[model samples]
Target: MTKTNNIEKAYDFGASEFNRKMKRITQERLKRGLPVSLDIPNDATPEELEELKAFDAWTRDGQPVED
Candidate 1:
């Protein structure tokens, strides 16, 4: 497979795994009657998009911790 194809696959897997974990955590927090929060922007600037892309790359590399 091409490099681009491999990158896409890695990003997809990372995103899916992230979503699954987030959903589980949210559910558990709700069951406990605790507040859970997410900071998803409705509109993103070019810099923000670039930063997000970098974060995805980090996640793809198996380093999902946010700084």
Candidate 2:
């Protein structure tokens, strides 16, 4: 499987963990809107890229992709 596929599967397998992390992120964002967006590092892995892509696509519809 591709790295993106694997990461997507792992995300499904770890749904609870994902929810917890997102909840924390949302609460933090609500409490303190950032003045500047943080940049992702240059050497990020394929999986990291896929995660960000999935977040962007999914958050709008409140849906998770099927693994």
Candidate 3:
């Protein structure tokens, strides 16, 4: 449907823009000797990706983590 297509397009555009900003921020941080927030490698495995997702879910978007 047209609505689904538009939503997918919006998601793709947002994801692309986010990646662009992250890459720019990462580059600037590297130039300034600052630590980057994300550090997943190009060859990351499924387990690594899942771990990252779980970690993000627990720590991001106002999600509370138990001590």
Candidate 4:
């Protein structure tokens, strides 16, 4: 008998699509001058912060994060 790791399987299927949707929503909020709240932990890394800053700049300039 084999056991399935449902959570891992779900993540594998949806992670990329979920990230894309979230990025789009974030950019739209930035364009509208609305707050963008993330679930980042307090111990987030510097790289994460830098990426977020870059995304903010791109969205402010009417650019999408993925492009």
Candidate 5:
């Protein structure tokens, strides 16, 4: 007896979620700037820590790490 199942309703919900995500991404892009490239140390992670142990960068010395 229920008639709540409808394609239009499903599409409306999906579109609403998509719009919300789009807005959030746009805001972050503006804050961080677009086309950003990250150059991290080879030992950035636990796995990479060993590989990059010998490698050193003058810029990273005593500087806080940013992911």
Candidate 6:
């Protein structure tokens, strides 16, 4: 029997890809400074896109901290 299943491989691939894309976005945003526009990819899943938008909004809001 194989050690890794297709589903596991697919999930890992998706997660790694998401992280890689996020890293690229982070670098670009850092260069351009905060309050950056939504830079999500066209092929991003709906959930990913939503998360990106929410994160962008949070950053634009100055990422408030709870005291």
Give the Cα lDDT of each candidate: 0.51, 0.48, 0.46, 0.53, 0.36, 0.48
By summed lDDT, which 10 consecutive residues of candidate 2 come out lowest?
A: 58-67
Q: Which one wins by lDDT: 3 or 5?
A: 3
Alpha-carbon runs more than 4 Å astray in model 5: 1-15, 35-67
Residue pairs in candidate 5 whose N, alpha carbon or C atoms collide under 3 angstroms: none
Q: Candidate 3, which ten residues in sequence have the lowest lDDT sum?
A: 5-14
Q: For this target, which candidate reaches the highest lDDT against the unseen true structure? A: 4
The candidate that achieves the highest TM-score relative to the unseen native structure: 4
Question: In model 2, which regions exceed 4 Å deviation?
Answer: 1-39, 62-67
Candidate 3 global TM-score: 0.37
Question: Which pairs of residues have clashing backbones in candidate 6?
Answer: none
Clashes per prediction? 0, 0, 0, 0, 0, 0
C-alpha lDDT (0 to 100) for residue 6 of candidate 3: 48
Better of 2 and 4 by lDDT: 4
Residue 32, model 6: Cα distance from true site in angstroms: 11
Task: Please write out the lDDT profile of model 5 over residues 10-44, one tens digit for every residue.
Answer: 12211445534444544455467664222467448
- State every prediction's TM-score relative to the real structure: 0.39, 0.35, 0.37, 0.42, 0.29, 0.38
lDDT of 4 by residue, 1-67 (tens): 1114542211221135665666688778877889977556688787666555554444345544453
lDDT of 6 by residue, 1-67 (tens): 1113442211222245555455455556766875445567879996676566555543343332222
What would the per-residue lDDT of candidate 2 be over residues 20-55, giving only the tens digit for each residue? Answer: 456455445545864323346699887777666555
Model 5 shows how many backbone clashes?
A: 0
Record all residue pairs in model 3 with backbone atoms less than 3 Å apart, i.e. clashing: none
Where model 6 places Cα greater than 4 Å from the true spot, the runs are 1-35, 63-67
Cα RMSD for candidates in order: 9.5, 6.8, 12.3, 11.5, 19.9, 11.2
What is the clash count of model 1?
Answer: 0
